[model samples]
Target: MSSPRPVWTGLVTVVLAVAPALAACSPEAAPPARADAPVIVPGAPGQSGSGPARSPAEAGPVAADVRFAEAMIPHHRQALEMAGLAAARTGDPLVTAVADRVADGQRPEIAVMESWLRSLGRTPPPAHDHGTGDHGMSGYGMASEEDLTRLRTARGRAFDTLFLTLMIRHHEGAVGMAAQELRRGRDRAMRAMAQDVVSGQQIEIARMRGIQRRLASP
Candidate 1:
């Protein structure tokens, strides 16, 4: 045999050269997905939400899902309006921060809902007043003109108090709507979204109550 060192080096080079090709063809040798791999859940037309995913075979959206999106769009818009009022009116950093969260939270939800509507071949409805119809307080919690007027003119602690009160009521209405979606919606995506609304709004409601209690103290 020629030098053993040369033969060993040639064998090592061949193994290195073919290893990537072997791995590509060998399913068993393929790299496993990392547990920490990023999970992207598509939300709006081009966005994503968090948490587990729906089944690919999930049924198409039902009436409850449609109604949920339609009603929630306006409900969320009112919340965004209410939250916007805080920035210019409150001296409290915590109040402004909570207001920012409300607006930030609802805006993307609106986009996701609208995207669902468009995907279902429905035109997104114009932004307007929240309609209770038969659902009443269960479906939408729209602030009255008087309620909004009071908020609009309020300043200092009054604004903070009014905002917390109205928002708690608003979140309660959202929770109620989510409850209905859980009961009646068929689409997996909408149902999952509704569950999120219920869980998230409940947490916010508790936080607002705590803030309200703090405000109540002299």
Candidate 2:
């Protein structure tokens, strides 16, 4: 009643001074201060805050992304070899045109995929090691050795027909790999490449299918 303001101020001052003493006396009075830097949990890398921080891609690509590009390189290699044969082996202008376009489009894509693998510190599969059986490629419409032999030996319209047939199957394999990457890959650039593979080869598939029908008709 007389002057509570001074009393209140004094009381606040006392509490402010005494608070640290109280906290120091009792271990449970207050929790410890948090760290400025990230806390690292032990037992495993990247478990929570373990190890140094990393960029998005530095966490490493999922198996699907790496495998997709690795498998596709030789996949495209086989396609390029087949495309190279069209000019000398086939008489149809349409087949030759498609071969030229496929080689043009895929050469850059192979370079891109190879660069991507190198960026990830991965070794891209060698062109020759990508056997038809590797990475379940047999399931993805890969051409057999016999298939290539028949195509290599085919002449004129026979070559055109076989080339289109094999090209369509090969494109189907690429589309299948791209679709798997779209489903399971985490890397954005690789996923974009996968999407391109899917879209581009689907278009080729349609074109080859149309050509196949035309060639079959009387």
TM-score of 2: 0.71
Q: Write candidate 1's Cα lDDT for 1-218 as tens digits.
A: 11111122333343344333232222232212331222223355455545354442343444566677778887888889899999899998878877877876777777777766655456565766533233344435667778999999999999999999888898899888889878767555567678878887887888789888988999
Global lDDT scores for all candidate models: 0.67, 0.68
Worst 10 residues of 1 by lDDT: 1-10
- Most lDDT-accurate candidate: 2
Clashes of 1: 0
Q: How far is 77's C-alpha from truth in model 1 (Å)?
A: 0.4
Please identify model 1 stretches exceeding 4 Å from their true place.
Answer: 1-57, 128-139
| TM-scores for all predictions | 0.69, 0.71
Lowest lDDT 10-residue stretch of candidate 2:
30-39
- Best model per TM-score: 2
lDDT of 2 by residue, 1-218 (tens): 01111122333343344333223222221111221121122334446534564343432345666677778888888888889888889888888878987888787777777766655455677766544555557677778888888988998989999999888989998898889877767556667778778877888888888889999999
Clashing pairs in 2: none
Deviation in angstroms for 5 in model 2? 81
